[model samples]
Target: MQSLQDALYNWLTIKVVCDVRPDDKAAVETRDFFEEILTAQHSVSNIETTKDDLMYYISYQQGEEIKKRRYPRELIEIMINQINQEPEKYKDYPID
Candidate 1:
């Protein structure tokens, strides 16, 4: 089992599907993004170093619902791209 710190680190850095109408293309993109990240060399999280830094929460806010998604560290770039393309959709998010 992953620890809270592990989960938080992954959640903070991963490319999760926050808000989407559920499309195949998006799903494929997410999957591919995850795979790409998994193959990267800098997959390790420096938890000790970042313990004092400001961390952001990656979640979806639709109406009154605030859903959290657990994303892998490898998918961060893809998630950023998605957030950049859909600024309005992710207005509440700080994916920069």
Candidate 2:
């Protein structure tokens, strides 16, 4: 049987990789923005960046589950707009 601590650890640790197209400066900016949000939430265990993708190893406490998905370019643009327009709204919430 697994100990409670082990189970919790497994639940908290999640790895996700995000891929973006064009590999341009804008894509880099998007990755940076997401990284800042992740760092502020204390959920990033590791981050690996490349020309076209970002690999994130995240860990959060119980009750906080990070969803793993690919973010389309349009969504990234929307996130950039939101962050620029209402940075305060995201100050308390973890990155989605």
Candidate 3:
């Protein structure tokens, strides 16, 4: 139970479906943006999206008071791309 809870808290292992159209012809641009762990047991509270990019909200346990940071969209995209390309680099990210 402890490991399961840790897995759930650390990683997002859910299959989310959306009603949208996919363009196969559209080429994906995989930029070597991030080269580190973005989901290394960090506490991610909420993620908000905007017209241009995304808003990544993550909190941290600092002694007593919880600290947080709102990362920009570019960073978020880089992190996602890194996570997707994990254990297999130089591959195009899946269009999900």
- Separately for all candidates shown, the number of backbone clashes (residues 3 or more apart, or on different chains) is 1, 0, 0
Clashing pairs in 2: none
In Å, residue 81's CA in model 3 sits off its true spot by 3.6
lDDT of 1 at 79: 67
Clashing pairs in 1: 37-74
Candidate 1 per-residue C-alpha lDDT over 8-79 given as tens digits, one digit per residue, 9 for 90 to 100 = 444444423433423435544544554334334324322221212233434433345544434433444466
Top candidate when judged by TM-score against the true structure = 3
For all candidates in order, the CA lDDT equals: 0.42, 0.37, 0.32
lDDT tens digits, residue span 20-95, model 3: 1122111221110110122232332332222234554545443454555554545445534554557364333356
* RMSD (CA, Å), each prediction: 13.6, 13.0, 11.2
Ranking by TM-score: 3, 2, 1
- Could you tell me the TM-score of candidate 1? 0.26
Which candidate do you rate higher for TM-score, 1 or 2? 2
What ordering of candidates by lDDT runs from best to worst? Answer: 1, 2, 3
Model 2 CA lDDT for position 23: 36
Task: Flag regions of model 1 displaced more than 4 Å.
Answer: 1-9, 12-74, 93-96
